[model samples]
Target: MTSPFASKLRTNYCPSDEEVAEIKALLVEPCLRLKGLDDKITALQKALDKLTQERDSLEAYVQAHTALISPSRRLPLDIIQEIFVACLPTHRNCVMDAREAPVLLGRLCSSWRAVSLSTPRLWASLHVVDVGRLAPVHDSSSRRLEERAALIPEVTRTWLGRSGQCPLSVSLYTFPFPSDPVAPTILETLIQVAPRWQHIQFTIPAAFLDTQFQLAAKDVPILKSIALHQYDPFQVPNLAWDRLEVLRGSNVTGVAISGCDLVLPRLPLRWTELTALSTLGSRDSPVSGERHISSQEAMELISKCPQLRTLSVLFEEHGLFAETEAHPIVHPLLQTFHCRGNVSTFTFLPGCLSLPELKEFTFLVHLPGSDAYMDDENGRPLVRFLAASSHLESLHIGISQFSSSFLQEILRSFPPTLQRLRINAMSKIMWGARLGSSLDDAILSVITPGLGDAAPCPCPALKELQIDRCTAISDSALLQFISARAATLKRIQVDFAREVELDIRPSLQPFIETGLDICITHVRPTRKVSAWEGLPHAERPLLD
Candidate 1:
């Protein structure tokens, strides 16, 4: 069998030479196809390169043409200066981060740097809240002070030199420690440059007075407004502020002036030229006893500010003194009075009664002792004072402690000229035996008569009313009263306690149904009620 298979295999195998040649030919055909593909790729690459070169040339031509037609010069000097001024901050911050502005503008080119440097107003307002933060550690404290002192004068000169008599505003605040005696020298330098200074604010610590007396003594002739904090006026004796229009003193401890005692000298009388003055007492100061401003002293100060229009005084305690006498005659030109603290009993002097220009008054009253007076005795004088202001437009009274009768008396005393009224958090009951009766009924009865007839509200000028957080008053009666007088009422806000039901009435249903600006602010079930919540969200906030 093997011999026969070998003969057959040899016969078939003899024809394989042609088949091998055919197989070699098939392998060579694939190599030839690969060579054709390589040729196609080379041609495509050359075409792509030629197209890229042409596109680049076209772009360059277009760019050159565009540059030829467009303006190549820089913006006008005036326009550049205006842009730079627009970049400066308007707010008075203790520290100014303006170091980058000058450097960046300067680096734009030599011309830009010159323009930026030449613009004095851009650099004139030098605010140095943190000298250390602005300078490096290697610069000694003395060197920093000298540098800081020199900044104002240099900038002032630059501004005056460039702008020629343009108004300038300068603000400086230093926190120099007692050991640093260079602050006074710096302040003296600032005063010497004060002729061009329009606005100056100083927050120097009390320690600077120990080093140099001139820190507080220098006279500022062109200074319109000066804000001094933690400074002793006694240290600087000849400090005559002639053109000073506004003077603010804060945390002024211990130091006193020979001519001016504890009480600020009456502006037009003692200082004569003062127009607006503000003396803010710290929260730590005593409210009662001799430490408080005497009623006489307060009157004297008020009288001196002849042209005084606005006055704001904050007391540490509610009642400064237990005086029943009327306040000293206030300035006739006074327009606004803001008193913050627990002053339960206040009497406006006879002169304060007829302030023709008075428009707005805010009183924060806190009654002391259980037997607080009602009727004319408690706060009728203030009410009368308010009533006398024919131009009175808005009134805000915060009554912390008072009886319903007293509140009623107060409402009765309200002037008919009042356009807006607000009653803040006030007690619902006090004095004698009306404790069990509904506080709402008592308040409504007191206020109802003042609301005028059912046809027209009592306060005809009254347009907006807001009531908040008087737990004793029934919302129904309050709303009913408002609805009857709704013709003049525009907005009503009712913020009530969780436990209290509004007890909506049928008459007030129309106001609520008509979508009258009525809002009911309910106290969050788990959260505590805030005093602010008790306040009516109306234009004029009231005490009750």
Candidate 2:
């Protein structure tokens, strides 16, 4: 193994001080050169930073310029249309103003204007609440009403035309006491579009339905719903259509006649096929001379309309169905029934009307000063009916006062599947000062579901509760209840509670943090009991 470099190899080498000094001298020259190289690196780093700043500044300017003609301006027509649809207002109150919703959306720019104009749904819902209030171009006070009436036709015609072939939902109201009679032209304009009407709600003057008036309901093949509200009692005219025919069953399924003036014989449409019906001022708002309808007449109406699914009425007299007590009026498909009137209205309901499939019940009754909700048997029908509705899910109660024991009993008997409960406690001359906070305390007890012996939590499936008016609940009890049910209770709306406004929120924060929707409003109670609490025999009460 004789290697090529073997002759030059050296062994056992060690550095001497003299030899190390010479090596150090050679390294000093290179170390000195390293300082200059570091300085050069710093200078280059500063230049790079400056270049980076300039590049960023230029890029920002480019982006700012590019955004002027951004891709959004180039969005597809269909996407822009969807955006316009999304911008439609989500409110039902009707008015025509330059600042509101769809109109506002149209006025943004030319492109938006075209898109809004092309959307039929945007213009299909028109609410002209009051003829006099509709702003007119002319400003003459003496001629204001006349001028507005004159322009009504033009405005309505244009609005309806914009809807193209869409079924119309029109709310047209005439002046209650017109200083000058409304022109015939306005009525003519509306009647012209009767064929396309699907939903029409009217609050017109009594004279508007005079014998001379005529409607082309014969052409309304798809007229499904119509509501007529009246404050003054007038005989609903014998409305007639030349010949009403439809491709299928009667398209008109919902009817609302406000006054008893609308006798069954006077009604023009098919009553047997109706799925929803409402009548107000039945005996509730009767003039001095004319208020008709006995328990017999009302019972007869109900007997004939076997298919009615939803019924909301205000009955002034009790025992509207007593004559039919022998044979109950059972509506197998009825799911929602709301009735409002004095305590007497539902007194005789138990023996007569039976709605087996009803799921939601609402009763707003007045409080008689001397009467008790439970002792007087005013709530018997309510309790009896709710006890029977095994599938009932929602309850809306607005009464003069909510007694603690009374509410507890109702909740205890509420359908086990109940999910939404609304308690609106309106004032009624103190009705003896409210058993203060007892009602809310009772509620806390019911919902809290006490120890090993007490019944299961009332409304165990309840996810929402709304309590408005009255001062039955204080902050302390509200917090305790919410904290206990925070896991299952999803939302709560408590309006006009002073104590809750002052102190409940801080305690509620823990529940809210975990996803509880809670609202507490502070409102000073105004004394309007005189307006709403008038006895049925007393002067006709006007709402406040």
Candidate with maximal TM-score: 2
Taken over the whole model, the C-alpha lDDT of each candidate is 0.53, 0.65
* Span of ten consecutive residues with least summed lDDT in model 1: 251-260
TM-score of 1: 0.50
In candidate 1, clashing pairs total: 14
User: Candidate 2: where is the Cα deviation over 4 Å?
Assistant: 1-71, 89-94, 131-153, 174-186, 211-213, 232-249, 281-299, 318-327, 367-372, 376-381, 399-404, 430-438, 451-453, 497-502, 525-544
Maximum-lDDT candidate: 2
